[model samples]
Target: MIGAFCGSFDPLTLGHVDIIERASRLVDTLYVFVAVNSEKRSMYSLDQRLAWLEAACAGLPNVRCAVQNGLVVDACRKAGARVLFRGIRNGQDCAYEQNMAFMNGYLDPDVETVCLFTKPEYDLYSSSNVRELVKYHQDVAKFVPACVLKTLLEQEEMDENIN
Candidate 1:
């Protein structure tokens, strides 16, 4: 089955990569969907996030990244995906994702949502938290892939200047 993972992925953290990798193995094809939330201010632009995602998942031939604005179920339909892949870190995340799954079901019952519990090591890391750490110049090499870290480092000066 074709599967889709949808998220902002502002900086494409390793935790996100882990989910993509595992999900890629479970389905014939995996689409990494990045929502273009116009109301949300992101550390990285949609293009940067998509590029980072592409770079991070370069090793996985079945994984593809796309940016779109609208309901995730619509994106899933466009990709011809039959499953929506999600990662849950805790009860809170589970509850949130469950609600989303329910809504997705309402949108299209043909697609199913599969939530994976986060690996303990990655449970505490998220794009927002990692972005906060980066803003303070804390080492984030451990939280993201080498390519993502490189982009962060390369754009560090620009970020500082903007701030």
Candidate 2:
């Protein structure tokens, strides 16, 4: 059955990619959902996030990606997904994800939520940290995927030239 990993994906980090790689192997098809959250503004636009994800997931046959707005359960249903996958890097992350999973279950009983543990190297990494590093002119090569790094660098250069 198809499964989906849904998140804001402000910028696709190595951690998110790790989750996608593992989740893809567990299901017939993996849909990467870039869900929009209105309450919190994102560093990058939805279009940019989607582009980065497309580049990061290139050549993955079963991995499909799209921007999802509205209820996550609706995104799962629209994608014909049987599972809503999340990545947990530690106990704190696990607790948060578990609560989300439970709420999603309450919303849609037909879809199951699964959490995959992140690799040790990416355990403490996050897109917010990556953005902070980029803002401080620090190398975030270790935190984000190559595609994201490339785009980030290019955008940074553009901003510099603009200034």
Candidate 3:
């Protein structure tokens, strides 16, 4: 079965990698769907996120990233994915995700959401934290994947040039 993992994936943290790796074990093929949400104001653009994702999963088989410009359910349908994979980090996340799952089900009953709890090792890591570290010029090599680090550096160069 094809599973769609949808997220903003601003910097593709290690936590994100862990979730995807676990998801891969459960599905035949996994499509990492990067969504564009204006409200979120991500540091990386859609193209940048996709590039980072591609680099992170470069050697991994049966895993690919794509830009899906719509609701999660619509994106799943467009990608021909049967299940949606989400990584829940804590109780607060669970409550929010449960509501979203129900709403998404209301929109598309055929598409199911499979929530996976984040590994304890990465329970505290999040995109928001990653962004803060990057903003402060802190070394985030440990928290983010290599590809994401490359993209972040490249974006810094672009920003410098624009200035």
Q: Which candidate is the best by TM-score?
A: 2
- Which candidate wins on lDDT? 1
Clashes of each: 0, 0, 0
Rank by TM-score, highest first: 2, 1, 3
Q: Please, what are the lDDT tens digits per residue for candidate 3 over residues 1-163?
A: 9889978988789999999999988989999988887688877778888888888888779998889888999988887888999999999999989998999999999899999999998999999999999998788888998888877788788988999
Could you tell me every candidate's TM-score relative to the true structure?
0.93, 0.96, 0.91
Q: Write the per-residue lDDT of candidate 2 for residues 1-163, one digit (tens) a residue.
A: 9999988887789899989999999999999989888777898999999998999899789999999979989999988998998998889988898898889999999999988889898898887787788889898888888888898889889999999
Worst 10 residues of 3 by lDDT: 37-46
Question: What lDDT score goes with residue 47 in model 1?
Answer: 85
Candidate 2 deviant stretches above 4 angstroms: none
Compare candidates 1 and 2 on lDDT and give the better one: 1
**How good is model 2 by TM-score?**
0.96
Q: What would you estimate as the lDDT of candidate 1?
A: 0.90
Stretches of candidate 1 off by over 4 Å are 157-163
